[model samples]
Target: MLHIFCPHCGELRSEEEFHASGQAHIARPLDPAACSDEEWGTYMFYRDNPRGIHHELWDHVAGCRQYFNVTRNTVTYEILETYKIGEKPQVTADGKQTNAPSTVKGQGEKV
Candidate 1:
C-alpha cells in the first residue's frame, strides 16, 4: 500500500483515500486550434511512464477532493514529496526537501 499526503487537510492517508491521476506538471498547448492532428494525438495519448523519480498528479477523492502532486520512486515506492496544486514542489537539486509535503506515503504523518 502507498501513503498519500493531502496538502489541504495536512494528513497522511492510505492510498485508498487518494487516487493517482497521471503524470503531473504538463503544460497545455498554447494554441490548440493551431496544433496538427499528430501533435494533438500525441498529447492525448503519449505518456512517459518512467521507472524512477516520476512526478504524478493525484486526487484526494475520498478525503478532501483536492488535486496535488507527488514525487515518488516507482521502483521503491518511496515518496519524496507531496505539494498542493498550482505550485511547484520545492524539491532540492539532490531530490530532498527541507519541508516535505504534509502527507505520507502509507499514512499521513506530520513532517
Candidate 2:
C-alpha cells in the first residue's frame, strides 16, 4: 500500500484514506464566458495523463478532508512529496529545480 503524507494532517497515512482527483496545476480559462465551445470542451475534458513524474490533486477524504498536491513517479508508484494546493512541487523530470509541472513526451513509455 502507498503511504501518503497529508500536508494538512501532518501525518503519513495509507492510500486508502486519500482519493486521487486528477492532474494538478491546470489553469482555468481566463474568461469562461468568452471561451469557444471547443476550447471549453478541451479545458473540461482533456488532462495530461503522463507516464513519468506527475503532479496530482489528492484529497484526504478519510483524514483531514483537505486537498493537496502530490508529486509522484507513476512508473514506480513512488510518492515523491506532498504539498498544499497553492504551493509548487520541488521535483521535476527535467532535473532542473522548478515548481512548474513537468512534461513528458511519450504516451505509455517511461521517461
TM-score against truth, every candidate: 0.80, 0.84
Q: 1-111, model 1: which lDDT tens digit per residue?
A: 766667778887888888889988887899999999999998888888977777789899998898888877777787777877676665543466547444333323322
lDDT of 2 by residue, 1-111 (tens): 777878887787778888999999989999999999999999999998888788889999998899988878888887777888787677765424575674321111112
lDDT for 42 (candidate 1): 88
Locate the minimum summed-lDDT window of 10 residues in model 2. 102-111
Global Cα lDDT for candidate 1: 0.74
Candidate with top TM-score is: 2
Stretches > 4 Å off in candidate 1 = 92-111
Candidate 2: residue 34 Cα off by (Å):
0.4
* lDDT score of residue 9 within candidate 2: 76
Q: Model 2 reaches what TM-score against the true structure? A: 0.84
